[model samples]
Target: MDVRRIGVVGLGAMGAGIAQVAIEAGFDVVGREVSDELGTAATERIGHFLTRKVEKGRLAQDARDAALGRLRTTTDVSELVDCDLVVEAIVEELQAKRALFVELERFCRRDTVLATNTSALSVTEIAAATASPERVVGMHFFNPAPLMPLVEVVRGELSSDDAVATALDVVDRLGKVAVPCHDTPGFVVNRVLIPLLNDCVRVLDEARVSPEALDAAMTNGAGWPMGPCTLLDLVGIDVHVHASEALYEKLRETRMAPPPRLVAMRNAGLLGRKSGRGFHGY
Candidate 1:
């Protein structure tokens, strides 16, 4: 199906980024927020990012204005009824995501593609919440979705081939690469990346090297664009913890387990960049 109108069900970083990307791709975007405050904040956040791009000479002002014109925000999920595709980018909890899917099924047509932006949760479980499980799939966009080029097109057990093809088409329309993967904990990137970050945390917890030194080694010696510690902070420590716990629960692997220091940091409310402090202070 041709996806011209897109619905996004959260105003958090991921949702906002996905909305902006859709708007920039010339698709009308309707975003649902929990409150008026978040609605306003999401709009302003997207506007600010566009403004930055304009300032950096990466985006034209006219194009930014045009994209902004295609964007709309609301607090009602019913407003998304006209959307050809609805992507849920809310919290990581399975119950919350399932509940949202149930609510979405009420308003959305059975043919309208329903997708979740879940990083590590079960797409099969989320799809089970709706009657037309074949129409449900996982469209996992990375952090800062507009900037990230990779979109994981995850297929649930019952997801239809048409649903997956529609999702891949939408990703291509947004000028992003689509990687197909089965529904699994952490999908692809997180499944491999988080364990490396966990090892870095363990090294820090053991007091073997300073965070700066460890990061420097990875950046200078390994030639990584950003060290694992910095990437962890950028991705948010709490997010990493949750993804790790979810992986460990399903896989029962030591590498997927959240390290002791990660648990301590999350308990202390040091949730990385969003919280202003984590492995290193923002």
Candidate 2:
């Protein structure tokens, strides 16, 4: 199935980014928010992103205007019925995600592919929320969907081959690489990356190293372009904590356990770049 018109549910950072990239790729995008205020904010966020591209000569004036013209926003779920595919980028709660997909299934056509951007949840569990489980799949894009190139096309137990193929085609159309994987805890990338990120946080707590020094050590000593401290800060300490805690609960492994420092930081609301203060001040 060729996907042209797309529906994005939830207009937070990831959702806004996804909508921007899709429209930049020449697809008609309809975005949904919880309220009109949020809908307007997400629209402005996308516009700002496009404006930055134009300012840097990365996007042309006409192209930026065209992308904005193809974008629409709404608060009603029923309005997404005509979309070829609907992707949910809502809060990372399983129950909430399940409920949204149920509503999406109610409004959207039977052939509309329902994709979730869940980072550390069960695709099978989410698919089971709908009568037509075969239409449900996971299209896990990274934090910055516009800049991130990898798209994990996850197939749940009941996800049909057609749904997976449609997702793969959509990813290619967005100029992203599609990596197919089965419905597994944390999927592929997060399963590995979470453990490493956890270790990074743990090291800081166990040692007396400053965040700057830790970052420099990794970048200069370990050959990593970005250090753990800086990377975690950019990724958001709370986001890393959530993913690590979820994986730890599911697998009950030491490697998946979140560091005590991260838990405390999350509680203190040191959420990195967005929060303006994480490992270092923004």
Clash number by candidate, in order: 0, 0
Per-residue alpha-carbon lDDT of candidate 2 for residues 160-239, written as tens digits (9 for 90 to 100): 99999999999999999999999988999999999998887777767878888888888999898888877888999888
C-alpha lDDT (0 to 100) for residue 208 of candidate 2: 75
lDDT of each: 0.93, 0.93
Q: Which stretches of candidate 2 lie over 4 Å from their true place?
A: none
lDDT of 1 by residue, 1-282 (tens): 989999999989999999999999999999999998999999999999999999999999999999999999999999999999999999999999999999999998778999999999999999998899999999999988989999999999999999999999999999999999999888999899988889888887576887888889889999989988888889988889999999999999999999988888899998888899887887
State the number of backbone clashes in model 1. Answer: 0
